[model samples]
Target: MTAETDLIKLYSQRILALAADMPLAERLEAPMASVKKRAPLCGSTVTVDLDVEDGRISRFGQDVKACALGQASAALMGQNILGRTQAEVEAARDALKAMLKDGGPPPGAPFAGYDVLEPARDYKNRHASIMLALEATSQAMAEAQQADCA
Candidate 1:
């Protein structure tokens, strides 16, 4: 098989496992902030709700409706977001975008698992789907912070 085929296989297998075992897959009953994002390129959507305490994520929940890649991305975010701050999530989001669009380095630890989707860099059509989770999480965090200040 060609290199592209190999990459595709790896991406598929990893995504399948992540999606099947997605963490924090349920929606919260009363989140401090809730936000939904859609990736127009793939019609992938992810809705995230979270509670913050002392500027850190205290709880998180999400409703995901997307392709395997989107699901995997959300799963990773769910797994590591329990103690993250808005700035951290935004940094990871920006780093992930740069990695996919400009060949920047993958995100650092905590969010480093995103590197698994590196093969997606070659498939521009998948970028939006991959970004859904990060975007939604960022929005939710920001909103929750604002609410706290109010």
Candidate 2:
């Protein structure tokens, strides 16, 4: 395939549209937990704010500063974040990492949409940025869990 095709494949219209429509694009005023992650290779940063209750996400928000790929990943996470448990978030994170780093398949429902990011596997440098939302969410969940137990 041509270089143009590669670019087009990586930056498809669906990905771009998801990036444009960032759900939960605001920070929560009193988040139960918050975390920020940065992709050094691309200087992409994402900060997530969340509230958890009864072992599930009750509220969520994010501040995304990255390319279309990162934004799209965040969009997918935001779309599926509500009511998710720590186990679900961690499962998605692990599955996404395995998919990108070890050629594994995407996670099941609630996170299967991340299959769109399959193209990102070919670009190692973009992996960190693409995984930012998941990383931040996982960290935030941990923090919330700790506070809940405290």
Candidate 3:
């Protein structure tokens, strides 16, 4: 196989592997906040639900349908953000955006174990698919925090 083909295969395999262990569905208690995002160009959609308590996320669940990249991104987000605080989540979001836009390493531990997403920085069009879940979850968390403050 050509070098380009090999890279694609490797990336696809990594995404699939990340998604392989995710539960088909997740359950959440009430007082949960929800947000949805769509990449119209790719027909990718992700809806995230989160429950926050004492400023930390107590639960996270999502309904997602899209390409492998989207699904993998959702799975990764779900797995990593379960017990994080809103601040931590926001920081990670910022770090990810910085990494994508300015091309640098992530800022902190919130992104610690998920460095595989770094490859996505160069993936261009695939970036939207990869970020769908993160965007949804971040919006949901922000709304949830707002409602809590009100």
The candidate that wins on lDDT is: 2
- Best candidate according to TM-score: 2
- Give the alpha carbon lDDT tens digit for every residue of 16-59 in model 3: 78767554236455746988799877888887788888888887
Per-prediction tally of clashes: 0, 0, 0
TM for every model, in the order presented, reads: 0.93, 0.97, 0.82
Winner by TM-score between candidate 3 and candidate 2: 2
**Model 1 Cα lDDT, one tens digit per residue, 1-150:** 799786676577777899888899899998999999998877999999899999999999999998888888888888898999888999999999999999989889788787888878887888998899999999898899999999
lDDT of 2 at 43: 99
* Candidate 3, poorest ten consecutive residues by summed lDDT: 22-31
Ranking by lDDT: 2, 1, 3
Output the better candidate (1/3) by TM-score. Answer: 1
Whole-model Cα lDDT of every candidate shown, in order: 0.89, 0.93, 0.73
lDDT minimum window of 10 residues, candidate 1: 6-15
Off by over 4 Å in 2: none
